[model samples]
Target: MRRLPWALSLLLFSAAPAFAAEGLDGKTLGLAWAIPFLGMLLSIAVMPLVAGRFWHHNRGKVAAFWALLALIPIALGHGIGTASQAVVHTAFLEYIPFILLLLALFTVAGGIVIRGNLKGAPGLNTILLAIGAGLASIIGTTGAAMIMIRPVMRANDDRKRNVHVIVFFIFLVANAGGALTPLGDPPLFLGFLRGVDFFWPTVHLFWPAALIIGALLAGFYALDSHIYAKDGHKWLDPTPPREISISGGINFLLIPAIIGVILLSATVEWGEVTIHGTHVAVASLCRDAAFVAIVALSLFFTPATSRSENSFSWEPISEVAELFAGIFITIIPVLAMLQAGTEGAFAPLVALVQGPGGAPDNLAYFWITGGLSSFLDNAPTYLVFFELAGGDPQRLMTEGATTLAAISAGAVFMGANTYIGNAPNFMVYAIARDGGVKMPGFFGYMLWSSVILLPLFAVVSIVFFAG
Candidate 1:
């Protein structure tokens, strides 16, 4: 209430704000403001690989440090009131809701466990990958991976040459499969929150997703067949295989319940209320509240055996929450700069994506965004290119549909280029390694993506995005 003075000053400084929703002014800002955001992303990408133990222990603290680097300056320069607006606006609108959805998905997936083993024949392996890919859009990539990966590993545990199965799983289940719906991946959900329709990705991305996933499944089946033949077509069952048992069966229902709430939020309008000068929709409030409820309900009703069997812990979601808080805070200035378009510091980048006659080049949008998503967290990368292309959901969904499609596909699919690209990619890798699947090393994994995914992306670019 007392922050009106700084608020006015900051408002004045928003010389050329591109987004009506954005609070920060990018025209008056410079590249210096990007340091914290860049630092935060680099920490996420590099620290764990280089300083594994230190990162494990202090990742939360590191995130806080970068967030403070941005917040402290804002508070001092714009006044506590203005800085408070920045935090409140981004938190309520993007970060909190994003975390809540992920938390709900994480909790539900952890509760459901896949039991029993089957022969890891080429046909069965291909079918499992196909199922996981289909399920990715419903249960989320992380959830599907959590439920499906164990069965896959168990099925192929006896195979002498089975790394291809896990690698293909990482490509399809962990990344590309998630391209079809907002529930499938973090980036799409961010799009939804930013006013993209709940089914926008489903409609726009379905074909591209089908193309990549089908291609991956076909490639996987062929590779697995050759390998299976080498192993003498062994249908050799591993140990005493029991019929698949379902634990935490309640979570299956809860997942649809989670989706229902989000859908309701999108479908129904309940009005808006202002908090600290920012207006928030009632449906959004209800949706977030439902997520909290779902989390609690999932924890209470699901069998304890389900969690213990899955080795479930709060750590994964905890890390996600911590890292994203820093990202949402630090990215404010970056978005502002990108939003500024040719008038801002990122003119060169804007130019790079520009094609003949000043139109956005779909191919550039695909590769550049995907290239960055290969190393950076794909969610934030999506938001960056999203804002870069223009922050209007209406425009992006209509006249800019092809460009938006390119951005969405690139963010979701090329995340397989590196383990760090998406939350589930590295996770599946670590789990596979722990289960003794002989997963490839980081660069070696990139080599796989290079030989397999790069060519496929080229075909995608030619087929859908060439402009």
Candidate 2:
């Protein structure tokens, strides 16, 4: 309650008398980013102590607590009438369920795929992860992550030293590789909604993606080589390997269908429509129906035995659902305030980079944001930095090739900085835990990445991007 006065005073004193653009406050996009981000930081700092004391025994409960705290700022409406209304509505209605549905789809897909590949050969496992990462360009990050994570984790089973390899795999393949297409990451897709040419990022991000991929492949090979050399005695079995063909390779078809639905929804203008005489957005109705169809098809068509064999209980996904419930809640308010501050002028930093004298500084900001994303949720963090690169009174003036390149690089590569930075990070960690790898918690995961991954990225920064 006392905090309310301080917050109001800050807003009143700090609020501009007004802006030339009316809705727009006419501030630097980067400054606007600080609003929600500050809230995120405050939540992050407080969450650990709060959760440790009250929710000590339960990570799910702790996540819930923090997420609710994050929602407070958004709930207050950020002092903006219209934008705040939209945010409050989106947070409670759109965002939460969107996450849940996505999580559900991912869990189902991963469960189905990984169950069959539980005993996949080592080389095959490497190929699967690599292919999955490559496919992220086509599907979104979560799609590829869901399909490939279990197989990668299972393939690495019984190998203790090579666990971090999975972490890097999630960083590069599942997350960063998706930078090429709007379909790859949510922020880029949001860019697409705002008028970015869909194919542009793919062409431009190719070089940066290659650089990061090359670095990761080398790292994986080196790490795997060391592990293989040390563990050669246990490498092969005298008995011939059992064939593991997918029983429901047909079930996989549902995935593409799901993708098509999303694409169709994006393309069609289903303004407001009545469903059973109820008012709702046409786009939303399409989404819900599509997901329901996909889930129903998978459940009915899939063999009952296959589910049991794969341990396809709802438990693992339940955990992911629980974790994100909190994450989304906490970040909503911060995003609202940040959005209010920026007033939708957030993506012009790319133009600034190519502007008279901003490329070098803009590039530096990209690296810092990416580095931070490795620890923080890269979604909002990406937006923050993406907006910064956008420049003052930010606008998407340029094609965003260079800026998109930087955004892709940071959002994807730097996600390796921490386990929770990207959805794939948690997915991989969950798979490992289910498979018994005993992955580290928040900071512990960062420590490992900081010591190992960050230095390698530094080399990447110096050699490929900065140079």
Candidate 3:
């Protein structure tokens, strides 16, 4: 389409340089630099429970307030060069591309209208989540989640106790199911971009991921069945079942375009464009350009009724974009500290992952990477651990295969531990809440992940990741 060419040309107008400066020296930054980041997370976690009305109405304002807390100090303490470089680098090299990918996936997937609601029987519910889990590897977790979540919700819309179902969906479809492929999750995709073979996760993580996914599905089915039986199974259907149909099928075409854009960026190299000391590949810029085209095309071509009928709203994506913007900016110091490794503040964190005789402890790698990823953004967490473990793909793939597998599984699987743990987790939470599912609040959701997934991951570590 003509739109595609125009969008490609949009890449010519790159982000204006913000003047390269010496980067934030994490070694010089005290633990106090992490205050904004921690406060931001606490605000997200506590503000909702304490001031539900205020948080709902002014989430963006809260996000901005914390973002400034992160920025102003850097400008005052470190100077404009460091501040500008940090924000610009994050905006260009990381956050924009991150948001664009989510936006394209969210737009394209949201347009798909699953026309009829089926009875949300335990058996049918299990099958739907299972199908969604299957699609996660192929379409990416966010896409799979966006496409499947509504229909699953619709089918269970009549149920009195449906919250658990959505929780398990978050666990399986949004997290564990994404463990098997680079395309399945952001962390693994980061791994792929860093020179891990494309099929590496698929091969190494298959059994461990399968075991976790299968266990979650089974647990969800059992829980749903028990709840359904308690509800007396004879409740009047809110909207009686109708013949299933899928609308906006044409929008599905954008999926491959999304995949192709990512693959193009990864598989090809173009000259670099440095913006504020961050060198972004021209190909990555073009990829972002292509995503803009795909989103526009999706919006223009898809029938408006398709989204309206599906109860799709832009609010979820808007909230995610706003909140994650603050997160990425504030997290600059935290990531830098981790990146500083042994020389920086969290040096003792380095020792935990090292076993007797200085060999890397696979299980410790799994737990620590997972624990940090449970709170920090998992993609960069994966990258940090990847560097700590020698940063050699060839060596990691062959001799340190188990260690690589542990990091991969931890980053992908433990992201379900909290709403903010994975991008898709929060998006799914917002959408479900909008759909009137009474989704759990931040810590409440953590309780669910702790009770269900933590034990399961323990089994996985013992079986597969033991050093």
**Candidate 1 deviates by what RMSD?**
5.3
Clashing pairs in 1: none
RMSD of 2: 7.9
What TM-score, computed on C-alpha atoms, does each candidate reach? Answer: 0.94, 0.70, 0.85
Of candidates 2 and 1, the better by lDDT: 1
How would you order the candidates by lDDT, starting with the best?
Answer: 1, 3, 2
Cα lDDT for residue 183, model 1?
A: 94
Q: 61-150 in candidate 2: lDDT tens per residue? A: 455445444434333434334233333344333443354345435534643544332433345545665787787777567767766665
Ranking by TM-score: 1, 3, 2
Backbone clashes (count) for model 3? 0
**Candidates 1 and 3, the one with greater TM-score:** 1
Candidate 3 local Cα displacement, residue 313, angstroms: 1.5
Q: What is the TM-score of candidate 3?
A: 0.85
lDDT: worst 10-residue window of model 3: 4-13
Error of 2 at 464 (Å): 6.4
- lDDT by residue (1-467, candidate 3, tens digit) is 22222222222122344444567787887888878887877777667668989998887777677777888787788777777777777777666776677778778887877778788899999999999998788777887898899889889888888899999999989988888777788888767756788778889999998899888888988888899999844656677778999877668788888877876787887899876577888998998899899999999999888888766777666766777677777777777777677787867877888888778899999999999889876876787788678768889999999999999998999999988778789878988998889988888999999999999999999999884
Clashing residue pairs for model 3: none
What do the candidate models score in CA lDDT, each in turn? 0.86, 0.55, 0.81
